[model samples]
Target: MLQNFLVPDVLTHNYLVNGFCKSGDLETAKWIIIDMLCRGPSPNCATYNTLMVGYCASNDLDKALDLLSTMSTCAIRPNRVTCNILVHALCNKGLLGEATKLLGEILEDKPESKTANLITSTILMNGYFKNGDISSALAIWEEISKGHRTRDVVAYNVMIHGAGLSLHHSLAYRFVCEMYKKGLMPDVFTYNALLSLLFKEKKTTEACYIHGVMSKMGVPPNIISYRVLIQGLCINGDVDLAKEYLHIMLEDSVLPDIYIWNSLIDGYGRHGDVQQAFYIRDQMVASGIFPNIFTYNALINAIAREGKLVEAHNLKTEMIFHGVYPDVVTYNILIGAACRLRHVHIGLLLHDEMLKKGCHPDIITYTQLLKGFCLIGKVINAEILFDQMISSGLMIDHVPFQIIIKKHWRMGELDKAFENYQIWLRRDK
Candidate 1:
């Protein structure tokens, strides 16, 4: 249809570019702007602002600044949208100092600009929170409250998340209280953020209090809310309470996901209750909730820790049969268990499988493998893997390097050990 129409005007070009930008097609949008420029309708300030927004959305701040320079050269004055995009980009990048200077520039030029009032304050508040500068965040919040007649939900959510992130749980609670005082009802996000944080802090009592508040406010708990509470109770060793929460969740018609079941299994495993963990797994399968790699890993680790090697190995085979491919963590757990049980052949076979599957071994994976080799007195093989790790561009940390050095020294290879020690010292310096 657009192809059948007459050539688009500047406004039509801007509209198309905005659509493309919002939909994440920045390169195509740039090409469209170039085509528009070649067709002799000089790009206006709106066009430049639209392009700036595109760059901001793509997180290409350097290109956005370059476009700003071009706008200046073309004598195209940047408007509120342009400033807002720049401020948001800078804030996201943690360039709070530069964002402040830009805000100063805007206010100096247009003191009465409503866009200046909204975007600048919002950006500053969010930036301060993200940077963990809570005092500054609160100051800005207070300032905004004094001058602005309306505060939106995003603003409140940001403050809540910031408080939670900074470990100011009490302040976060106070913010919720203030929300009520301002006659604003707390939203799902507000409850979720606070509940998640409280769980992380192991403040299960406080989390329950918030959950009660959520119920009183008539905000039904979402899946994430239930997951957080369950995980918290599990970690706190309140397995019975965790099970009760699961029952309540089911009663509330919230279907449990794999994560919820995994946490329960893991909690039982941590308490050395492998039988109960298996029972939960059976229940999960019976309920038609397919177990994932995490579920298998938890069961494998639990059984392996209990020295039930045969059952653990069988579960690994069943995981494969069920089409749940083992991940790096799975291999790490299996290999570590094999090494602990003196099953070197199994560990070696698992390592071969990992390489065949093209899973790039991370530092932790390599460290565990190297430790297993050293434990089995295969010093030469460990050294080969260590050297390969270095040649593959992986950084060797101090602990693993020290392990190799100590092994060499214990084997009376002092000269070789000292040579490597010198190299490490140079790098450390």
Candidate 2:
């Protein structure tokens, strides 16, 4: 196409650049933009805005800012769209201060750009919520309510989800009620967000009440709603009620996904009911639902907790046979189990397996292994692993370092213990 055309129009260039950006080929997109500029086709506000949006979408904030500056130099004034894109990118990166500053500048320039106002306000409010500044979020909400005649459902949903994540479930419920007063019906997302909070707080009775209210209001419960409710019940150790909900979901023809099964299995495992948990797993397999990593982890950890090493080891073998590769969490559980059973050789073997699978052990994994070594009086091995962790660029935080230091101290290795203490102090400073 380029060979036939002596020069491409600005619209054609904009379209191609946007296509590249959307496909995440930012370098190619930039090349196309440069080609357009070299061809002497004057770039307009829309062209600059499109490029800025692309940069923001790609999370190239620095490049986006540079483009913003270039836009001004090119004498193509940025539109509301451009400002909103920048604000959104800043918020997404957790640069709330910068986002707020850009927003202030935009509002100061054009107080009546309601489109920019709405978009920026939503981004800023969400950023505040994410930063755990509920006071700031509420203030922004009040500002929006005062300015706009009607708030969008998205704004309300963000507030609800943010509140829930922050453990202010009651405030989230109040937002729902407020939405009701404004004649804005709660959608599936709204219910899901509130239900997730209820579950997080273990407010089973309130969750059930919400379920009833949802049914009474003729709001159809989606798969997410059911999943959240079931998971919540499971997390609260109400496995019987979780099972009841599972049955209800099956009867309602809402297919139980892997996550739901994992939650149920994890719940049962937490309650030390390995048999019931395996029963659920069997049902899952019978229903043709393939078990994922979480499934195997739950079962392995549960059986290991019961001192059923043979059964747990068999499950690990079955997991590999099924091609569901274990993750770091799985290795941690296996190592912990082996440690509890005094099977140091087996634990070390699992550690080697983790390395063979190219799965790097995280701090928790190392911590568990360290405890295992300490328990078995293998201080030298623990020290070696600790050094390996540091050499691998893992941060030697105070807790784990202190644990190793104390262990060495107890063993009368004063020099090594003091050296570790000095390292911790240096890092702390």
Candidate 3:
């Protein structure tokens, strides 16, 4: 239908281009834009803006900036949307200083652009907050309050969200009250900010109260709302309640994402319900959420606790087959499990496997093996591994040192034990 009536005009081509851009097919969008130019509708600022935004979304900031020169040569002037795209992309990449410089250029170039002022100011505020410079973030807010520009709900939400992220609960709550006093009825984002802050503070009751308030205010909860609730419940060890919420999320038609599934996997595992952990993992796969490293690690830890050594090792094999190659933490869990089961040979073999895979062992890896050797009274072998660890230039942690010293004392080598203790004490100094 579009091909019949639209006739490859800029208007129709733009809709197609934007569709591709939004779907993250930037190259397709670029081809469409070029086709529009060749077909002669003369691409406007919005055309370049759309393509620039696509480039920025793809993290090709260099290409996005090059569009500026391209647009200028075509006598197409960039608008606030174009500048904001660059500003936001820089901020999102944590290049705050560069973002601020671009913001300054936008303001200087388009002083009367309220959109530019608001967007640049907001980007600067968020960038400062993300860079852990709360004072600078608040300074931006203070300037906004006193400047010619009025503070909008978005600016307030950024400050609120920033405070929540920084764990400044008091300041976040204060922003909530301030926004209300300004008659800026807290939206879903505002409520979510407060909810997340409450969750982080472990104030689940307060979060619940905020959830109720959201329902009463007719502000519908989004995915983040349900995620925070599930995460908070899981963290607080109410796996059953967390599961109930997950059911509610399904009922509400909110498709659970990877994070939600991981939370459930970890929560059930920690609740001593390895079966439930496995069940959730299966459920996740059935729901089309493939397990990642975290998923396998959780299952491995739970299975190890149940003394299902063979099953835990099988999961490692399954993880490899599923293409979720084990990480350092994966090897650490397996090695620790093997050590606890007095299977030092298995731990040593796993260590060798990690080295073969180019996953360099950390101090935890060496310490776990030392503890394993000491557990089975292989003190001499443990000491040899300890020397190799030292020769490998790995920093000696207290755990391995204490493991060796304890083994010496237990074996009635009091002088060796005392000598090791003296060495550890000297290292501390």
Candidate 4:
């Protein structure tokens, strides 16, 4: 095929480039593109776009940008696909300023090309939301919404998901209504965003109503649809309802993944039904799904909070035996449990174990240890741990200082209390 200068050869080579890039063989993909450039059947925008996508996917943004310049040198104008791929790649790196500028450049350069305007704007709007720039996201949405060519279902979906992330329940609903007004039916994603938003707001009733409406409208709920509901219901203390949905999800032929299984296990365990949590774990294994670190963490957290350290430790051993090693969250839970149960020795030992496991102690781990030491009148140990926190580069927060100050004050050490308070004030300021 390469020996022949056929018209479809370029497309065949482009497909090969895509395959190599997807498989993380950027070198071979770039080689093919270079070969196409040197030989007959010269690479076009599609060819360059494919290679640029591969570079972007590999986080070689610099290489991707360099290829854009090469596209210009080769007399190939960047099309909508090219502009979108680059804009999205820039956005991914949190370069909103650069991304926005690039977007404007692309849109301005191709005044006749209206196809990419909506897609790029949607990408930019989503970037803003991800970076916690709600105002900028809304500003982009407002600009695009005013443009008939740019206002589409995908743009609406971005707005809906952004609203959920921002917890703007009314805003999401407004967008949903606006979609209807524009003759754009709300999609599965729209309802899922609403489900996520309502759950975050603890508006369980509204979330359920939205789920029901999704069914009524004949928009089949996918796996995400069920996962969001189960997780939210479990979090909001409606384990029973979540369990009911799990059965319904299976009935509807929507397969439950590890996440759904974890949610159920955690929910039941949190509701003080450890037996049922274990039952779910057994069922998960029987269904050929092995537990991950999260599965163990959820189970450990449930029993550890109930002062069942022995059982939690046994599970920890079980997880280690099964090669599901403890992460920071795992140790944090065990330490918190030990502190609350007045087992400061166990807390200290666990802290050491976390280091041995090559897991750095976070602010939470330090705070829990500080509390444990302070509670036991180990003021000197607490002070040493506080210094370690600073040395370890953990973000110092109000809680740790408060714990130390209260401890000193309780022990009638006015000078020490005032000294720590001054340090806290200085750091905070």
Candidate 5:
């Protein structure tokens, strides 16, 4: 097509450029832009912005910024879209300082620039909250509230969500009240945020009240809403109440997903009601929601926690029958259980099985196995496992160090124990 079309217009060039950019072929996209410049219809600002966005998406932010400079040199004035692409990329990468500087520069250049609009402000505020700079996030919102940027429902949601995430439940509630004063209705996201905060704070009555308000407000509860409530109730050790919500969801024709079932199963399993957990799993299967790795893992973890190693292992076979192979988490739960039961032999067997099944152990796997060895008074074996963990490019935490220290002290090796304790102290620093 390129051979037949002698002179491709700017639009055609941009079309090809966008295709390459979206496909993550930034190098090819750049070459095409250069080819367009060498040919006719020199690239425009949109052309440059497309390539810049591509660069940012590829995580080559430095190159993207350089392209922005090139745009200025070529007398192609960048618009708000160009600024937002860079700001969002920086914010997403957790480079909040750089993002703030860039945003300030864009606002100075174009005060009316939509680049400093609600979306970008929300992004900046979210970055601040995530970085533990809540004061900065509140300051940004103060500016928005003062009419620097048009305050919208989404902007309110961001602040509310951020407050909840930062563990400021009272502030989150205040924000919701403020939203009502501003004549803005809270959406499902807003409720989810508040509900999650309330649940975490053990304000179950308040969370349930908000759920009632949601129904009154005509914002039909979503699957996420149900999931959050169920999980929260389960977390508070109210599996029976959580199961009631599940029944209500079913009555409302809201088909529950695997996660919903898994939460209840885990709740019941953790409460030492293995029968109830299995009943939930049976209900899940009846609902045509096939148990996945997560379902079986929950069951295995629950049974393992109850010191039912044989039952947990039996569930592993059942999991395989359902075509779900054991992952590292499954083995870790079993290994931890075996250690707690003083069955180090079974834990070692599971470790070898994980290796034979091509499932590499992670840090938790090594840590659990080390603890098992240490608990069994096999300090030499624990040391070997610890060394192997470090050689595999994994860092050792104080848990392993403490195990070694305690074991040494028990064996009356005072010097060795003190030496390991010093090493642990330095590592902590």
Candidate 6:
């Protein structure tokens, strides 16, 4: 344990940096690296890479990139791992140009990194797709395929998944066939991508067919696979089929997570099946998956729409009892319902409670409350609320003006009503 007798290895020092960075202690992580430089166990590429990753994780990407200069000062050349990490972080931040430039610099410095280039290219392609530049992503794919490097399933997956997300059916299918032609087997990701695309296209028949194909081809669907299947089906208004897939998922030994349950509950609620929504909530709890705010929101929305305000209020109270405190969405739904029913006092109380709980009210929240107060002839309260909305810098259209003018007109204040009418007319124009 004597520091002088046995200095920590480079791996141990890197671990300390990783631990500190993960805990949001970048200062300590940097101090550890400085200590290594001042004392023994000279830092290596991995050590600086660890520190760079920490900087990136902490959102100080400039400092992370600066570590490259420090690495050079220490006479350590940054390797492909370092390049890939920075490239990935850059892509995630939507800095595609910067990422591309950095990748070029790395490849120019060391041109023998075929495998590393392929992986980084996939990340860049994905980044392009996310930024909605499908052509750029395809251009990246073309480069990879044209190169001598053998295209792996992962590269193909990135292309196919990108195409799927962008709803490019032709590209997704073309990639699937290309994978086969190149003698690369499609993994679970490949099929999942296809299924997702089919759902977006509303080709439910093809999606189901692909699910069957996955089973026959022995590409076992993971939790994400089933989730996409059920979620897409539920979204396309096939809650019944989605429920069937849930049973199939359990049979496949994939435990349904909270997301899956919430999707099903929301789907049934949307389908106007209040009892079924609650039934799903109970089943979710019975499976040892606690119902989250989303679960209760769907349930509350379903019944609240049916004029069952009491039941909806009780459910809101129950959310707190179960430790799922009401969020902005929760209050919004209740407040909107109360306004609809002309129960403006209930909406007011909910608004106050929302603020006390530190849930910031959005424009929708302010708009709803403003309409409620105006409807109940509380013009002073309505005006005060409107000032608060303007102070909050909320952007909205003429809807607020429409409410103000109508309220003033009903109160027989034609001059005030006419003034707002002019402003609304000019603003709308």
Encode model 1's per-residue lDDT on 85-192: one tens digit a residue. 888899899998888777777766745655456667777788888998999889878877786536666677788888888889888878877888888888888889
**What is the alpha-carbon lDDT of model 2 when measured against the actual structure?**
0.84
Instruction: Summarize candidate 2's per-residue lDDT along 1-429 as a digit string, tens digits.
Output: 569876777888788878888888888878876776777577777777777888887677898999989988888887777888888888889888898888878777856657568777888888888888888888888987787635877789999998887778788889889898988988778888888887787789999788768877778788889888988888787888989989988898889888899999989998999889999999999989989988999899888888888888788889999998889988888888888777878888888989998998788777777877887898888889888877887766666797898898998989999999888788789
Error of 3 at 316 (Å): 2.9
Clashes of each: 0, 0, 0, 0, 0, 0
lDDT of 6 by residue, 1-429 (tens): 355687788889899988998998989989998998898688889889988988888788899889988898889998888888898889889999999998787657746668988888888888898888999988877787687777799989988988877878798899899889989988998888888888888988789889988878989888988888899999999998999999898887889999999999999988899888888888888989998888899888888888789999999899899899888988898998898888988998988988898998888888898998887778999988876765676776777877888898888999999987886676567
In candidate 3, what are the lDDT values of residues 225-304, reduced to their tens digit?
88888888899888888898788789878899888888999999888998898898889999988999999999888888
- Where is model 1 more than 4 Å wrong at Cα? 1-15, 18-24, 34-61, 64-76, 111-119, 133-153, 177-184, 243-262, 268-296, 310-325, 352-357, 360-363, 366-429
TM-score-best of 2 and 5 = 5
Higher-lDDT candidate among 3 and 5?
A: 5
Q: Candidate 4, residues 1-429: lDDT per residue as tens digits?
A: 425844557788889888998999999988988888887468889988988988998889999999989999999998878888988999899999989988888757837656678889889999998898989999887776576574888889998898878877688889889899989988898888878988998988888888988989989899999999999999999998988998898788777999999999999988899889989999889888999999999999989978999988999999999989999999999999999888899998998989988998899998998999888878899999988886786788899989988988988999999998998888888
User: Candidate 5 on 1-429: residue-level lDDT in tens?
Assistant: 568976778999999899999998888999998887677588899999899888888889899999988888878887777777888888888999898887677657736644357677888888888877889999988877675465777888888888888888789889889899989988999888888888999989888889878988988788999999999999998899999999999998999988899999999998999999999999998999999998899999989988888988999998898799999999999989998887888888999999999998888888888888888788899878876775787767777887878888999999989987886787678
Indicate whether candidate 4 or candidate 6 has the larger TM-score: 4
lDDT score of residue 290 within candidate 1: 87
Order of the predicted models by TM-score, top scorer first:
4, 6, 3, 5, 2, 1
Count residue pairs with overlapping backbones in model 3: 0
TM-scores for the candidates = 0.72, 0.77, 0.85, 0.93, 0.79, 0.85
Report how far residue 311 has shifted in candidate 5, in Å.
3.7
**Residue 363 local lDDT, model 2:** 84
Residue pair clashes in candidate 1: none
Query: What is the TM-score (0 to 1) of candidate 6?
Result: 0.85
Model 3, residue 181: displacement in angstroms?
0.7
Best by lDDT: 4
Model 3 TM-score, all chains together: 0.85
Superposed Cα RMSD, model 1: 5.3
